[model samples]
Target: MAVEKFETSLKKLEEVVKKLEGGELSLEDSLKAFEEGVRQAAFCNKKLNEAEQRVEMLLKQKDGSFGKVPFRLDDE
Candidate 1:
């Protein structure tokens, strides 16, 4: 299967949320949209996890003098 970019999946998930919240779809259509939203959420989560792992790996000391440090947002 082909992977969607994180930004695309996130946008799709947001749209699904808006549709569900708007309460305009039939039960069947709502169910389908909910299912798609779940899928997009999972894909986005997976991509975020992969990125976090990469960041951790990159932060490790090059000369083996230090271990990997946890990543934190600068604003946090």
Candidate 2:
């Protein structure tokens, strides 16, 4: 599947998991699905991180004003 968007990629990953669980595919096909699933999962994770950063940059400060702040994962 050509994963053009995060939602599409996530849905593809779910389908891969279902196919793998069904135990109908051969070893080589199963391996291919697993690899694709890994790629899709990484893509979804990266998109989520980007969205979180955007939200963090728009956070309201203590002074009741919005400001762009560098988002640091370690701060969590």
Candidate 1 residue lDDT tens string, 32-72:
99999999999998887774344543454777676766567
Q: What C-alpha lDDT do the candidate models reach, one value each?
A: 0.85, 0.85
TM-score of each model, paired residue for residue: 0.63, 0.63
TM-score of predicted structure 2: 0.63
Whole-model alpha-carbon lDDT for candidate 2: 0.85
lDDT of 2 by residue, 1-76 (tens): 3336988988999999999999999999999999999998999998777643253457788999997767667778
